[model samples]
Target: MIGNDVIDLALARKESNWKRKGYLDKIFTADEQAMIVRAENPTLMVWSLWSRKEAVYKIHNRTAHFRGFIPLKIACQADGKVLCGGQFYFTDTIVTAESIATVAVLEERQLSQICYLQDREEVVKKEGFPYRKTNSKPVSISHHGRFEQIVTLTD
Candidate 1:
């Protein structure tokens, strides 16, 4: 039972001005802002934090009454791999297991003169009681624009 998520830093740089600022104030808190970013155009930093947040949040939905983005953290190094509070690292990679396994990919990239997203999700449920629901639903959302971002997800 593992999950990962990603977002385009370039797309966010070119596309969003309002959602960047709006979510900054609305979704992120003061400590979260201070912890991840110390820049003026904090949108990209915000998204970086967000991509990690969503990645982990997908695995464990928002159950912590956290006032800010809590499950996501990034190292202040060159490779900003998403961290899940522990030694967990999240990046573009693939892992395999013998039991049940699942994977999710969400990304936005700029190719040539166009920007697009490649989103996919896969679930493998092991042999268990079918009544309890052990498989995750694959979520894919694609958009075409200079920046294609998942604006919102209601539950």
Candidate 2:
């Protein structure tokens, strides 16, 4: 399975205050928080890790068929990987000035393709995996603000 997430940096900057007391503790593990604190750009690092965790969570939810919002329970590494509920995931992150996107696939699965779309309206209109012709794999898609990202997994 594959999962993906995207965050608009401008929107996040205007809306989120990561410096708020207890915020990091609520969503990040001690090791993750340490990485954020030591990062040259803490905001980007925080969102990068957050996107990874969220992507992994989506895959977990799809496979386990349950929903939960315990962010602190998801452990993320600076190198863009995640562990949650004893399952490890391979995560890849892309950070640009305007957005951050992350994709996660089960560690045991092989990722076949990745698709990124900037046109939110078009993505919303299409509304499903649009790259199946090129790669017949289960895909997960996510969008936030101006960014959209997809991750595909193959047998």
Q: lDDT, candidate 1, residue 30?
A: 62
Best by TM-score: 2
Evaluate all candidate structures by whole-model CA lDDT and list the values in order: 0.37, 0.77
Q: Tens-digit lDDT track for model 1 on 10-67?
A: 5545666635455556555566667556755455455545554554455333222234
Error of 1 at 85 (Å): 14
Tens-place lDDT digits, model 2, residues 76-127: 9766568888888888787888998888888633444455544333332123
Superposition TM-score, candidate 1 onto the true structure: 0.38
- Worst lDDT run of 10 residues, candidate 2, spans 119-128
Point out the worst 10-residue segment of candidate 1 by lDDT.
93-102
Deviating ranges (above 4 Å) for candidate 2? 108-136
